[model samples]
Target: MWNEILHRSWLRLEQNYHFNDSQNVLNVLKQAYAESQRAYHTLQHISECLFHFEQVQDLLGDARAVELALWFHDAVYNPKASDNEECSATLFQDLLKDDLSTALLAKISQWIIATKQHLPSSDQDLNLLLDIDLAILGATSKRFIEYQQQIQCEYHWVDSEIYQHKHKQVLTHFFLQQPLYQTTFFQDHFELQAKQNLTLALAGNLK
Candidate 1:
């Protein structure tokens, strides 16, 4: 099963990201994963997102484009910097020059930035990409706690007050939302549990 999935993913990437340089591609993936504070939200994160994406592949018009976006979405994550999305998008543009079409790169870049704001445009592929990126918001209790710890490790440099404030704002932002998961699949799988977890996390800090 795993091999079949891996083969399919490889085929997908080959058809989607036609980078001729294999070594460079591997290096990009390694660097992106290593730089991410949360393994669960980095390469592992993208992999999980891809898995879920594959399950609901038909829902997207350009599933391949979203997959490409996923590979490069978190490529330039810097905990302290707010321009990580822009940087990642730019990197994709530069790296894929001549390999990917100008229009396709623009779409991929837009999808990367969309992850910053959970509100993807009405475009189904972009919406699916953002939903997969935030899949953890609706994880189970044990998984959610693990995710919290991973995120904490990502910002070890920040002071407690700042981290708490920012984290609270993020949790509160989602909790205040009408629907935590914008995508139907995510709504079905994780919306309620994620709300419960966020509410608990916010309450825990108050204590």
Candidate 2:
């Protein structure tokens, strides 16, 4: 199933991107997914985001940059590293070389960095990619809890106190945002549930 999705995605990339070799793209995907800690940042994440983007196709008219950005967002996901986004963005630019426009490449790089900063933004594609990345926050109660557990597991190396503090800050930041979801779909589905989860997590950490 996973390979099927990867193959289909690679096919789409071949059609859309300037790449000629299928094996090279496949190798990059394999390496990145292998290095990711959880299925959250794995090939599954890329496939799922592609599905979400397709679902919101109307919202993403001429959104090739966002699609490319998603492909590399988690490519260099190193929990212990603060510059993963920068590294991933640079790596992608190098890989694309002169195939894509410099302006478009910069936009894609900006979108990837936005995933890490998550600041208020007017960029529709960037917002949509972020919403998809965090769509699980608005998942059903059981799934939401499962996501929390997975995130905690991803930070297993950290002591409980440090983890709790860092986690609390993140939850608090999200809760304090003007709109948890900048997109209509996310607002309709995830805003309330995300706030509830963040509130509970913060309270639990405090206790």
| Pairs of residues at least 3 apart in sequence or in different chains that clash in candidate 1 | none
**Best-fitting candidate, scored by lDDT:** 1
Per-residue lDDT over 100-196 for candidate 1, one digit per residue giving the tens place of the 0 to 100 score: 8888878888888888777847787777787788777777777778888888788899998999899889889888987877788888887888888
RMSD of 1: 2.6
lDDT to native, each model: 0.77, 0.76
Instruction: For residues 1-207, write the lDDT of model 2, one tens digit per residue.
Output: 656655666676678875755567568867887774764577767877776766775788556667777788878877778998898888888777667888878888888888888765787777888898777666666766766776787788999999978887887888888688889988986789888777776777412
Number of colliding residue pairs in model 2: 0
Screening candidate 2 with a backbone cut-off below 3 angstroms (N, C-alpha, C), the clashing residue pairs are none
Model 1 gets an lDDT of 0.77
Task: In angstroms, give how far residue 8 of model 2 lies from its true place.
Answer: 3.4
